[model samples]
Target: MNMSVPFSLLFTLIILFLSVLISSTSAKKPGDASQDLVRSSCVHASYPNICLRSLSSYSGPANTPGEVAQAAVKVSLSRARKASNYLANLRSQSKREQGAFHDCVEQMGDSVDELSKTLSELKHLRSGSFRWQMSNAETWVSAALTNEDTCLDGFKEVTGKVRSDVKRKVTNLARVTSNALYLINRLDQSRQKTP
Candidate 1:
């Protein structure tokens, strides 16, 4: 008995198998779905570029609107903490704008606290109480944004580098917080549409 396969047939089979493997590998990455969800979630944000950039690092597990919102809040909280520390340091180093620095630092602290609360609420949301929990998240995030604006407002009357520097930092922080709030609102809207 002689068993022989044609070279052409073997070559075709090899090509077919390789094509299937390539297609499977190239179609989507391991976490592409989650990343896509993150991108889509950021689209409606007030500052979409900031939202996408800030939340990109946390996109791996952001498979849902809620998860993306949580990521946004986490980013906001982290930035708020950094901003608060920066303000505190500036306050300590400055003697001229004592009152303004102190007020800005205090407001940034409040912003950080509100962002933390928003993150905590988002992380603990349950399907049964998702609406109520989302509402809480929205409120806290809004408060955080407000606190940031107030921090910036403290420097309005001041002139020169201190005000400019504080304004730059606080403005960046506020933009991120605004994006987080927009994402949270999108999440809330998403929940409302689900029957």
Candidate 2:
């Protein structure tokens, strides 16, 4: 007796098996509460798209507003650090716009420091001093946003590719920082509302 599966049946079985395997290995689940919470938190951000995009890779539990704020601050801090490094490297290689690059690098450095403080404050928030800690986080994040804007402003008098590149990078950093600040403010408000 010769038993052979039809080619179409074999192909269909293989496809089905692969699909099942892929679905089983997928990380995201339908109606995931953590993901829902993350989306809701991002809704309140000034740059909601930017907030969601930046925060998409955050692996922390999104069970609370404070956690979302912490994640946002972490994203902002990461971007700020990268921008600072980029500026430093550009400064070393550039001839023209050296003064502007120098100032931008210094401002970006301050921005990184402020974002670091904000992240630290968020991480150590105490129930007894919740309001105070949130206030500090807010202040630090806002300061970081300002610092990023100042860096971009330094390029106003400059022209050409360097200026445009600096503007693009710094502006994006400022946007993400602004979104982080918005999320932080929301967390503070949420705390205030809880009895």
Each candidate's TM vs. the true structure? 0.85, 0.81
Decoy 1 TM-score against native: 0.85
Model 1: ten consecutive residues of lowest lDDT: 90-99
**For this target, which candidate reaches the highest lDDT against the unseen true structure?**
2
lDDT of 1 by residue, 69-180 (tens): 8888788888888888888887433554787888888888888888888888887878999889888888988888888888877777788887888898889989998998
Clash pairs, candidate 1, are none
For residue 89, model 1's alpha carbon misses the true position, in angstroms, by: 0.7
**Which residue pairs in candidate 2 collide?**
none
lDDT of each: 0.84, 0.84
lDDT of 2 by residue, 1-195 (tens): 889999999999999999999988885775376677889988867888888887777876667777888888888888888998888987434554788888888998998898898888988989999888888888888888888888887788888878888888889989998988888888888778889
Off by over 4 Å in 1: 1-26, 91-96
Candidate 1 clashes: the total is 0
